[model samples]
Target: MHGYTQDKDEYAARLRRIEGQVRGLAKMIDNDQYCIDVLTQISATTKALQSVALGLMDDHLKHCVSEALTEGGDTADEKVREASEAIARLVRS
Candidate 1:
């Protein structure tokens, strides 16, 4: 199974909450809500997504990368590369 399987439900719940926040954002725009208020909500949503990404990265490193390291071969190298790429993407975002 995947490394995130254990926390899959938590991730799904967070995503659902973020989805609702996005919908609310759309409504605020449609209603011509204050610009600053909308911007604040957008920031909150962005931070929530970042939080989820960090949690997933931690789970990946703790479970998948750790397991690959124990094996000590090409798999370990690939996992390290994969994790590095993931971190790079997160940083770019």
Candidate 2:
């Protein structure tokens, strides 16, 4: 199983909340809300997503990576590389 398996429900709930935030953003645009107001909400939504990403990354390191390292060899190396690439993508976002 993936590292986030234990907290899967929590992640799903958080993603649902973020989904609502996105829907609200679209509604704000449809209703012609203030530019900065929309931007502020956008910033909040972005930060929420980043928070989830960070949590998942932490979980991966604590569980999946830890497990791989215990086994030792190419599997461990690949997991670390995969995690690094994921982190790079998160940072770029």
Candidate 3:
């Protein structure tokens, strides 16, 4: 099973909230809301997404990475590499 399976409901809830925020943003644009206000909402949306990404990374490290390490060998090595790549991508974002 996936590392996120345990908290899948929480993740889905968060994504749903983010989706609502996006729809609100579209409405703001349609209403010709202030530019800075729209930008602020966009920033909030970005931060929410980043929060989810960080949470997923934490879960992966705690569950998937730990399990892989116990197995050792090629699987462990690949998991480490994948985790490193994920961290790099998160950092870049």
- Tens-place lDDT per residue, model 3, 1-93, is 989998999999999999999999999999999999999999999999999999999999999999999999999999999999999999999
The estimated TM-scores of all candidates read 0.96, 0.98, 0.96
lDDT of 2 by residue, 2-86 (tens): 9999999999999999999999999999999999999999999999999999999999999999999999999999999999999
**Candidate 1 overall Cα lDDT vs. reference?**
0.98
RMSD of candidates 1 onward, in order: 0.7, 0.6, 0.7
- Model 3 residue 80 CA deviation (Å) reads 0.7
What pairs collide in candidate 3? Answer: none
Assess each prediction's global lDDT (C-alpha) against the native: 0.98, 0.98, 0.98
Q: Pick by TM-score: which candidate is best?
A: 2
lDDT of 1 by residue, 1-93 (tens): 778999999999999999999999999999999999999999999999999999999999999999999998999999999999999999999
Q: After superposition, how far is residue 91 of candidate 2 from its true place, in Å?
A: 0.9
**True lDDT of residue 70, candidate 3:** 100
